[model samples]
Target: MIRLKSPSEIATMREAGRVVARTLAAVAEAARAGVSLSELDELAADLISAAGADPSFLGYRPTWASTRYPGVLCLSVNDAIVHGIPDGRVLRDGDLLSIDCGAYVEGFHADAAITVGVGDLDDRARHLSETTRLALEEGIAAVAVGGRLSDISHAVETVARGAGYGVPPNMGGHGIGTKMHEDPHLANTGRPGRGVRLREGMVLAIEPMLIESGRDRARTARDGWTVLTGDGSRAAHWEHSVAVTGDGPVILTLP
Candidate 1:
């Protein structure tokens, strides 16, 4: 069931979102070539704990996974699209890293992700990252009272397609609240005027994952949790939890 949050509840969610945003910022600032992905995870864990918020991804196990997620953040690199488990591997130059993190505070949850290029990035990598960011911005802009979910999807698809990027199929965004994942799945590509209608107090996570090559074909990695582009092309992902408000879309996950 889709639940609409009250103003007070939205305020609490914003606090949770801030914790996630701050943690991600700290991690991004600390992320550098030669730094181990596991080390970044440690930094995020400490930051979340110090803020009195719990790491939502730690110990999380999806139905298909045999083991619980062992880190506080997902460190997806290059072809690894999402759910890349943080290991002792150190980042290298020209690597595109996508870090996804979540925080649970005051009985609410907020989730966000960002993709960044390490040390010296090439032109293609830089363009992919920028495109994903803009796609997310476009998606967020479509969240408003009386708007349909497809309005957001179309906005995101228009940006990606215009940039000659491929929107990943099946994987997209979702509603977020007390639980890490909730109702109202938001697809990256869709026809406008379709799907759920937006309403005040509704919160949605608008994430756009784009592939620089081929259309949206993905494969699960050997790790069983990580997803990668089937064509082995580079991919970028950006996400933000937004709430529909009386005025417009309010990005809850902001630092």
Candidate 2:
């Protein structure tokens, strides 16, 4: 169901969103070329626990996955598009990392993601990361009162498509609130002024996953969780939880 949050509820969700933003910021700062993905997960787990919140991603079992997710965060690297488990892999210079995190606080949930290039990244990786971030910002800007959900999707798709990037068709953003994923799915490609209409008190997570080459096809890894580009091209993802308001759209998970 699509739930419209009240003012008090939105305030509480802001707390959860802040925790997500702060956690991602800390993780990004600690991430280095020599660090292991497991180490980053450990740091994020500790931070979430210390803040009196629960790691939303840990133990989450989506319908398609064979087993529950075993990590506190989704750490996708290079060709890994999303849901990359944190294991024994160590980061290397010029590697692109995509970190997706979620937190549950006071019974409310907030999710966010970011893709960054490791030390001494090449120009191509840098461009991919920046474009993904800008696509997210543009999508968020389209989330306003009386606006259609496709406005948000169109804004995102235009930016990525115009840049000659491919957006994965199967995976896109969605509503976020008491649960991690909710109603009113947000696609990256769609006709403007279509889909559900935006209204005050509605919160949505706007995420754009862009592929560097080939079509929008994706495949799951043997691990049963990680998603990667079928053509083995590099991918970038960025997201933020946003709330529709009378004034405009408020980004809940900004640092």
What is model 2's C-alpha RMSD? 0.9
What C-alpha lDDT values do all the predictions have?
Answer: 0.90, 0.91
Cα lDDT of model 2 by residue, 1-255, tens digit: 689999888888888888899999999888898999999999999999998999999998867678999999999999999999999899999889999999988899999999988888899888988999999989988888998999998999999988888888768999999888888788988889998889899999999999988478789999999999989999999999899999999888876
Clashing pairs in 1: none
State each model's C-alpha RMSD to the native: 1.0, 0.9
Number of colliding residue pairs in model 2: 0
Per-model TM against the reference: 0.97, 0.98
Expressed as tens digits, the lDDT of each residue in 26-141 for candidate 1 is 88888899999999999999999999999989998866788898889999999888889999999998899999999988888899999998888999999999999999999988
Error of 2 at 25 (Å): 0.9
Considering only N, C-alpha and C atoms within 3 Å, which residue pairs clash in candidate 2? none
Off by over 4 Å in 1: none
